[model samples]
Target: MKKRNKFKHFLYLILALAMLVYALPLISFKEGWSWASAFGVAWSLFAFLVIGAHLHYLLGVDEEKQKTLERIRAAKLREWQLKWPEDTQRRQENM
Candidate 1:
Protein backbone atom coordinates (compact mmCIF):
# COMPACT_ATOMS: atom_id res chain seq x y z
CA MET A 1 0.00 0.00 0.00
CA LYS A 2 0.99 3.61 -0.32
CA LYS A 3 2.93 5.27 2.50
CA ARG A 4 0.05 7.59 3.28
CA ASN A 5 -2.40 4.69 3.56
CA LYS A 6 0.03 2.75 5.71
CA PHE A 7 0.44 5.70 8.02
CA LYS A 8 -3.33 6.09 8.24
CA HIS A 9 -3.68 2.42 9.17
CA PHE A 10 -0.99 2.80 11.82
CA LEU A 11 -2.82 5.76 13.28
CA TYR A 12 -6.05 3.75 13.40
CA LEU A 13 -4.28 0.89 15.15
CA ILE A 14 -2.79 3.24 17.71
CA LEU A 15 -6.18 4.79 18.40
CA ALA A 16 -7.80 1.38 18.83
CA LEU A 17 -5.09 0.24 21.20
CA ALA A 18 -5.38 3.45 23.19
CA MET A 19 -9.14 3.12 23.52
CA LEU A 20 -8.81 -0.48 24.64
CA VAL A 21 -6.22 0.41 27.27
CA TYR A 22 -8.30 3.31 28.53
CA ALA A 23 -11.46 1.26 28.78
CA LEU A 24 -9.76 -1.61 30.58
CA PRO A 25 -9.05 0.50 33.61
CA LEU A 26 -12.46 2.13 33.56
CA ILE A 27 -14.10 -1.29 33.50
CA SER A 28 -11.98 -2.60 36.34
CA PHE A 29 -12.56 0.54 38.35
CA LYS A 30 -16.29 0.33 37.84
CA GLU A 31 -16.33 -3.23 39.07
CA GLY A 32 -14.70 -2.22 42.36
CA TRP A 33 -11.78 -4.39 41.37
CA SER A 34 -9.08 -1.76 41.20
CA TRP A 35 -7.75 1.13 43.27
CA ALA A 36 -6.32 3.07 40.38
CA SER A 37 -9.10 5.62 39.98
CA ALA A 38 -6.79 8.61 39.93
CA PHE A 39 -4.39 7.03 37.50
CA GLY A 40 -7.17 5.60 35.37
CA VAL A 41 -8.98 8.90 35.09
CA ALA A 42 -5.77 10.71 34.22
CA TRP A 43 -4.82 8.10 31.63
CA SER A 44 -8.30 8.08 30.15
CA LEU A 45 -8.30 11.84 29.82
CA PHE A 46 -4.89 11.73 28.19
CA ALA A 47 -6.08 9.08 25.75
CA PHE A 48 -9.10 11.23 24.90
CA LEU A 49 -6.82 14.15 24.22
CA VAL A 50 -4.60 12.02 22.01
CA ILE A 51 -7.60 10.85 20.00
CA GLY A 52 -8.74 14.43 19.53
CA ALA A 53 -5.28 15.47 18.40
CA HIS A 54 -5.13 12.56 15.98
CA LEU A 55 -8.48 13.59 14.52
CA HIS A 56 -7.20 17.13 13.98
CA TYR A 57 -4.03 15.77 12.41
CA LEU A 58 -6.07 13.57 10.08
CA LEU A 59 -8.14 16.56 9.01
CA GLY A 60 -4.97 18.55 8.28
CA VAL A 61 -3.55 15.62 6.32
CA ASP A 62 -6.75 15.38 4.30
CA GLU A 63 -6.58 19.09 3.45
CA GLU A 64 -2.93 18.79 2.49
CA LYS A 65 -3.65 15.80 0.26
CA GLN A 66 -6.48 17.68 -1.42
CA LYS A 67 -4.17 20.61 -2.11
CA THR A 68 -1.55 18.28 -3.52
CA LEU A 69 -4.12 16.65 -5.81
CA GLU A 70 -5.33 20.06 -6.96
CA ARG A 71 -1.75 21.09 -7.72
CA ILE A 72 -1.18 17.91 -9.70
CA ARG A 73 -4.39 18.44 -11.66
CA ALA A 74 -3.49 22.06 -12.43
CA ALA A 75 -0.04 21.03 -13.60
CA LYS A 76 -1.52 18.35 -15.85
CA LEU A 77 -3.95 20.87 -17.33
CA ARG A 78 -1.12 23.29 -18.05
CA GLU A 79 0.88 20.55 -19.69
CA TRP A 80 -2.11 19.55 -21.78
CA GLN A 81 -2.67 23.15 -22.82
CA LEU A 82 0.92 23.40 -24.02
CA LYS A 83 0.50 20.19 -26.00
CA TRP A 84 -2.85 21.07 -27.55
CA PRO A 85 -3.88 24.71 -27.37
CA GLU A 86 -6.63 24.18 -29.95
CA ASP A 87 -8.28 21.57 -27.70
CA THR A 88 -9.08 24.38 -25.29
CA GLN A 89 -11.13 26.20 -27.87
CA ARG A 90 -12.85 22.99 -28.84
CA ARG A 91 -13.70 22.32 -25.19
CA GLN A 92 -15.05 25.86 -24.78
CA GLU A 93 -17.19 25.40 -27.87
CA ASN A 94 -18.50 22.10 -26.48
CA MET A 95 -19.43 23.87 -23.23
Candidate 2:
Protein backbone atom coordinates (compact mmCIF):
# COMPACT_ATOMS: atom_id res chain seq x y z
CA MET A 1 0.00 0.00 0.00
CA LYS A 2 2.78 2.44 0.83
CA LYS A 3 4.57 1.74 -2.40
CA ARG A 4 1.37 2.07 -4.38
CA ASN A 5 0.61 5.37 -2.72
CA LYS A 6 4.10 6.65 -3.47
CA PHE A 7 3.73 5.66 -7.09
CA LYS A 8 0.37 7.38 -7.33
CA HIS A 9 1.84 10.55 -5.86
CA PHE A 10 4.72 10.51 -8.28
CA LEU A 11 2.34 10.16 -11.18
CA TYR A 12 0.29 13.11 -9.97
CA LEU A 13 3.42 15.21 -9.62
CA ILE A 14 4.40 14.40 -13.15
CA LEU A 15 0.93 15.29 -14.40
CA ALA A 16 0.94 18.60 -12.56
CA LEU A 17 4.35 19.51 -13.96
CA ALA A 18 3.24 18.60 -17.46
CA MET A 19 0.11 20.69 -17.18
CA LEU A 20 2.05 23.65 -15.85
CA VAL A 21 4.51 23.46 -18.70
CA TYR A 22 1.71 23.27 -21.23
CA ALA A 23 -0.42 26.09 -19.85
CA LEU A 24 2.20 28.52 -18.54
CA PRO A 25 3.35 29.27 -22.05
CA LEU A 26 -0.10 30.52 -22.97
CA ILE A 27 0.25 33.51 -20.64
CA SER A 28 2.16 36.62 -21.80
CA PHE A 29 3.98 38.79 -19.24
CA LYS A 30 4.35 41.81 -21.54
CA GLU A 31 2.94 45.20 -20.51
CA GLY A 32 -0.78 45.90 -21.08
CA TRP A 33 -2.39 42.51 -20.66
CA SER A 34 -4.73 41.63 -23.52
CA TRP A 35 -8.03 39.84 -22.92
CA ALA A 36 -6.63 36.65 -24.46
CA SER A 37 -3.64 36.69 -22.13
CA ALA A 38 -5.86 37.21 -19.08
CA PHE A 39 -8.14 34.40 -20.13
CA GLY A 40 -5.22 32.05 -20.68
CA VAL A 41 -3.83 32.74 -17.22
CA ALA A 42 -7.25 32.27 -15.58
CA TRP A 43 -7.86 29.05 -17.46
CA SER A 44 -4.44 27.70 -16.50
CA LEU A 45 -4.97 28.54 -12.84
CA PHE A 46 -8.41 26.94 -12.85
CA ALA A 47 -7.04 23.78 -14.39
CA PHE A 48 -4.29 23.62 -11.79
CA LEU A 49 -6.75 24.06 -8.91
CA VAL A 50 -9.09 21.38 -10.21
CA ILE A 51 -6.36 18.85 -10.95
CA GLY A 52 -4.60 19.56 -7.68
CA ALA A 53 -7.81 19.01 -5.73
CA HIS A 54 -8.45 15.71 -7.45
CA LEU A 55 -4.91 14.56 -6.79
CA HIS A 56 -5.12 15.64 -3.16
CA TYR A 57 -8.28 13.60 -2.68
CA LEU A 58 -6.94 10.56 -4.51
CA LEU A 59 -3.70 10.44 -2.54
CA GLY A 60 -5.37 9.61 0.78
CA VAL A 61 -8.09 7.28 -0.46
CA ASP A 62 -8.19 3.63 -1.39
CA GLU A 63 -11.60 2.91 -2.85
CA GLU A 64 -11.41 -0.88 -2.80
CA LYS A 65 -10.23 -0.99 0.81
CA GLN A 66 -12.89 1.49 1.85
CA LYS A 67 -15.60 -0.57 0.21
CA THR A 68 -14.38 -3.74 1.87
CA LEU A 69 -14.36 -2.07 5.27
CA GLU A 70 -17.89 -0.80 4.73
CA ARG A 71 -19.07 -4.27 3.79
CA ILE A 72 -17.49 -5.76 6.91
CA ARG A 73 -19.17 -3.16 9.08
CA ALA A 74 -22.52 -3.91 7.48
CA ALA A 75 -22.09 -7.61 8.02
CA LYS A 76 -21.23 -7.07 11.69
CA LEU A 77 -24.31 -4.89 12.13
CA ARG A 78 -26.52 -7.57 10.59
CA GLU A 79 -25.06 -10.16 12.96
CA TRP A 80 -25.77 -7.96 15.98
CA GLN A 81 -29.21 -6.62 15.04
CA LEU A 82 -32.59 -8.04 14.09
CA LYS A 83 -33.28 -8.35 10.39
CA TRP A 84 -35.56 -5.69 8.85
CA PRO A 85 -38.66 -7.84 8.55
CA GLU A 86 -38.26 -9.30 12.03
CA ASP A 87 -37.85 -5.88 13.59
CA THR A 88 -40.93 -4.59 11.77
CA GLN A 89 -42.91 -7.61 12.90
CA ARG A 90 -41.88 -7.07 16.50
CA ARG A 91 -42.82 -3.41 16.29
CA GLN A 92 -46.27 -4.24 14.88
CA GLU A 93 -46.87 -6.82 17.61
CA ASN A 94 -46.03 -4.28 20.32
CA MET A 95 -48.51 -1.80 18.83
lDDT per residue, candidate 1, 13-88, as tens digits?
Answer: 5876668675864445555645576667677777667676666665566778889999999999899879796877
The digit string of per-residue lDDT tens for model 2 on 1-95 reads 96787677667767877888887876787866889888888888777886776576666566777899999999999876757778789899999
lDDT of all the models against the reference? 0.72, 0.78
Model 1 scores what on Cα lDDT? 0.72
Quote each prediction's TM-score: 0.39, 0.49
Candidate 2 lDDT for residue 92: 100
The residue pairs in collision within model 2 are none
Worst 10 residues of 2 by lDDT: 53-62
For residue 33, model 1's alpha carbon misses the true position, in angstroms, by 12
